[model samples]
Target: MDFRPVLHILMRIVLITAVSLLMCVPVALIYHEPVSPFLYTSLIATILAACAYGGRGKQELTTFKRREAYLSVTLSWLIVSLIGALPYLFSGAIPGITDAFFESVSGFTTTGSSILTDIESLPKSVLFWRSMTHWVGGLGIIVLVVIIMPSLNIGSYNLFTLESSFQEKIHPKIRSVGRRLLYIYLSLTFIETFFLLLGGMNLFESLCHSFGTVATGGFSPKNTSIGDYSPYIQYVITIFMLLAGTNFVVHYYAVKGQFRKIKQNEELRFYYKVTFVAGIAITAILFFQTDRSLETAFRESFFQVASIITCTGFATADYLLWPSVGWVIIFFLMFFGGSTGSTAGGIKMARHLVALKNVKHHFRILNAPNAIIPLRINSKPVSAQDNNGILTFILWYFMLFLGGSLLMAWLGSDVPTSLSSVATAMGGIGPGLGSVGPASNFAHLSDSSKYVLCGMMLLGRLEIYTMVMLFNPWFWKN
Candidate 1:
């Protein structure tokens, strides 16, 4: 396989990351903090990217083979995270490479997990940069490459497909789809920020939380997270988080006055059903079991459920403090994440929906030996390839969850901590139960455990196969 195209794409991604890093400089300057971190990293990234390109462009490679796509996409994220760690290291925000890499991976993966114990103590610029990682990493580094850097247009389609969620393209032109995705993303950020500011948040807090919410990323500027904010602010965040967790393709259709398509989407319908049911169940439990007022219980219940299911990881309460039933409900939601083609990360509701339907069809076929039954989704018959792919993905996901939990337990974590942390890390959902719950952080874990969790985060974000396929001899041979 040709390596130049991959290197060229990597350099462009690094350059974009460098530009994003520079955005934090103004925040640093405004807060009267050290700007050297941003300045130095940006300079180095720019130089490296410039040298990689050597001021030349190759217009011939717009589309590439599947193997090249996998390699480029994986390297893009790994390289971006490597560079993303530079600022944290330079600023002394995270004192070691492992911790910095962990935080950087969590940030880029939109996993709200953090190693920082005292989040409120970080400099304003550093905190802003952290949230910015969520925003940049939210829409995806590959999507940004396809949109902003025209020189890499040769293999842009491959990169776009590798990065996008599992949904049909919204536009005929891949570039148009990328552009629309960016527009919807930006519009949502602005709207959320505006409402948050109106709800008594200052500009910085508003922008930071807005970035976190719209990306379905759970990073917050305050130590208490959304709990520290007003009910109004929390409500606004909850609504936006729900929106972010829905498929962006659905949002694209809604923007063009195509409500019918949105309504007909099977994964979306299942997503809403799951969210409402989970929210209501938790709300009833909180209201009946706890002394929280009706409205308070309902709001907090809905907020936490949305946070977990969307894989956003934001917390409005210490859910561990809730009764046993609440814990069970939360853990159950861990397996069913937001819809596919959404910012939220988990197993994805689409795969679950399809797998369940396929199982039902299997029973029907067994009952009627010669029946010509077919699995269908949203009135369309599912392909055998898709059916097999979803089934395999689900199997691998559970196997990993089991293995990861066992590994965490062996590392000395408590049973609850081990199980939930494994679930959270693999699902890209921040905050697990027991020790790593919402009120806690991951700082106490050993370096070895942190490294393992980092690997899990990458696997979760890439949906397991892209990274796992790298280890297969046939994958490389192809």
Candidate 2:
């Protein structure tokens, strides 16, 4: 694999992260917090970017191939997470290396799991930079899906990428698609910020929340997450989280006034079906079992459902304290993720839909001795390669969940904490069950456990195979 293009892009990514760091400077100045943390981190990122560029490949980035693409994506997230930790370290917000990396990985993966027990105690600038990690990571996920992953063929995502309509709606060039998605992403953030402002949130909190909402990242600047906010604010966030969880392609079609295409999206349909069913079920649970009003029950249920389904991880209420059935509903939804081609993580609805179709096909085959059946999604027949890829991905997802849970338990966490923490980490959803639930942070977990969860976050956010490929011996072989 040619290292030049990958080197070149990594340099640019580091520079982009450096600029993101500098973005916190203004916030620091405005809030009268020390700016050294961001400035110093930005300086370090600049030097690393320079070093990466120093080894520039003469070939253009477009020349990078499959192996390089895999290396590039894996290294991009890992390196950014590595550099992202500098802020926490410099600011002394999180002082330990393991904890800092854990927080950084959580941020860059947009996992929203945090070790910070008192979020309100951090400086506004550090919090802004923290939220910026989500915005950047979210952008990274969007770019990878729209412009890169389609070509990589991971998880048989070609189902979405192979569609000709997508090419017509968005430009074919990588840079063009990235720019277009950036506009859509920024628009969502700004629009949500405006709405939150209208709901009486301050500009700082609004931007932070907007960053989290649009990214589907749940790292709020508040200790209570979204629980302290008004219903109007929660409702707006719930709606946007739903939007964020849907495939960005659907949003692109909606932007192009192509509502017909959006409506025809099978994965979007599946996503909505899961979300509403889960939401209504939780709403009923909350309403009958508690003293909350119908509207409050509806708001909290939908918000929590959207949060978990989308992997947004925000909380308007702690469902762990609710009826057992309420939290149980959430537990299952962790495995049923949002649409693919979106920043939201988990196994993804695209794979789940395919898995379902494949299962139904098998039942039919069981009734017929010899039958040729094709698995289909979005009215297009799925290739056998894609079928195997999707199912294998699902199987591996569960296997890793089991392995990580056991590892966590072995590391001394109780069964509930171990299972849900691993599940939530792998799902990129914050607030797991047990000790890591919405009301608690991961601070209590051992350093070994935090590191394990960090690894889970990367594998989950990258859709597993991308990162796991690096561990395979042949990937490094000539």
Best by lDDT: 2
Residue-level lDDT tens digits of model 1 in 1-478: 7666666777777887898888998999899999999899889888878876873347223554556656777887788788889888999988899999989888888888998999989999999989988898887832633332223222222122222332234223666767788899999999999999899999999989988887777999999999988899889999999998887767877898878777678888888889999889888999999999999999999999999999899998999999999988999888887866667888888888887898799899999989898888777676676677778888999999999888988998889988888889888788998899999999999888888888888888877876887789998886
* Ten-residue stretch with the least lDDT total in model 1: 154-163
* Model 1 clashing residue pairs (backbone): 61-154, 62-154, 62-155
Alpha-carbon deviation at 399 in model 2, angstroms: 0.5
Return the TM-score for candidate 1, rounded to 2 decimals: 0.93
Q: Give per-model TM-scores.
A: 0.93, 0.97
Candidate 1, after superposition: displacement of residue 37 in Å? Answer: 0.3
After best superposition, candidate 1 residue 40: deviation in angstroms? 0.8
For candidate 2, the per-residue lDDT at 324 reads: 97
> For this target, which candidate reaches the highest TM-score against the unseen true structure?
2
- For model 2, what is the alpha-carbon lDDT of residue 122? 93
